[model samples]
Target: MKELDKIDFRILKILQQNARIPMTELAEKVGLSSTPVTERVCRLEREHYISGYHAHLNPHLLGKPPLVFVELKLQSKSGNISKISKRSAENSANYGVPSGVGRIRLPD
Candidate 1:
């Protein structure tokens, strides 16, 4: 990764706060021309510093309440065990927990 200068940091901070901000507005805020601001944004994306853009939605509005965590357990410590656990979790209707804890009892 390339070292970010003050300008780059400022750009990232502004974009993170509001990804939809217009380039012209961003340029004005950053004291640069629209062309250079656009170029910097493109460079950030190309360098994978900016992965992708997304919208934040409220789950309650979508009729889904927030989820709660659940504890689980598994029987064996094997590669197949992990696969089985993952599959079981996915198949279950409850929130899918990919892994579970395991415990062993030794003979006295």
Candidate 2:
């Protein structure tokens, strides 16, 4: 991978805090005109530096009840983790879990 310059780093930092930032506002924050800023963002996406955008959703607004997390301890380590993970993912997908709602890790 190539090194990111100051502009790219700044853009990334701002976007990290608020992915929904407007192009005009983002350009101003990074000290660039909208056109060049847009092109740079497009290039960033093409280079896979910015994989995709996401929105934080409100479950209640969506008519979804409170979310729950469960951790299961498998009794056997003999099973292939890949298959187990795939099955779990399939189950979640079938049950309408948003693809972007990824694994949540709690600090130990």
Candidate 3:
């Protein structure tokens, strides 16, 4: 395997930012003509430096509105976790959906 040059590195960086950029624009940014840039991109793909192109989409676009995600870790699978869970539920019920001490405050 050969080492990547500055041009190759720049190409990879640009592609990461915008995978769907036109070949001519990408070539212009990297200071190369389309033919050489096209060949370089092909080489990059062949060498696995460029793996895949993907579409960037927002959560709303996918019909999944954003929500907070939480993960909890405990030392042991004991009653303490259940107690905490119950308290959290109580707080959520008393205040709002996500209401806890030292966390976000709910609207009045």
Candidate 4:
């Protein structure tokens, strides 16, 4: 990725706060023309700096009620743990669970 200048930082800051902000409004906020701002955004995405845009939704509103985190441990370490972890992640992704689960390594 190329080095980001002041304008690029400003654009990212604004977008992080509100990804849905229209390009015209973003350009005005960042003191750039809409066309340039749009191009910058596209470049950022192409560079993988911007993975994707999404809407933040309330889980309760979706009838899931409150959510909780559960730490999992496996007995085996010879790839069994990795296999189980992959399966869990796949299930969560498939079900579209908000704040979907992930694996975290614990320090010994």
Residue 91, candidate 2: how far off, in angstroms? 10
lDDT of each: 0.75, 0.74, 0.75, 0.74
Comparing 3 with 4 on TM-score, the higher-scoring candidate is 3
- Tens digits of lDDT, candidate 2, 1-108: 567899999999999999999999999999999999998888888999999999889776776655555454443554665565665676543332322233332332
Candidate 3 stretches with Cα past 4 Å from truth are: 67-71, 75-80, 83-108
Which residue pairs clash in candidate 4? Answer: none
Off by over 4 Å in 1: 68-108
Residue 95 local lDDT, model 4: 34
Candidate 1, 87-108: lDDT as tens digits: 5555445443445433222222
Clash pairs, candidate 3, are: none
- Per-residue alpha-carbon lDDT of model 4 for 20-105, expressed as tens digits? 99999999998889999999999889988888889888765665544444445445545666666566766543332223344432
Worst 10 residues of 4 by lDDT: 92-101
For each predicted model, how many residue pairs clash, with residues at least 3 apart or on different chains? 0, 0, 0, 0
Query: Alpha carbon lDDT of residue 27, candidate 4?
Result: 97
Ordering by lDDT: 1, 3, 2, 4
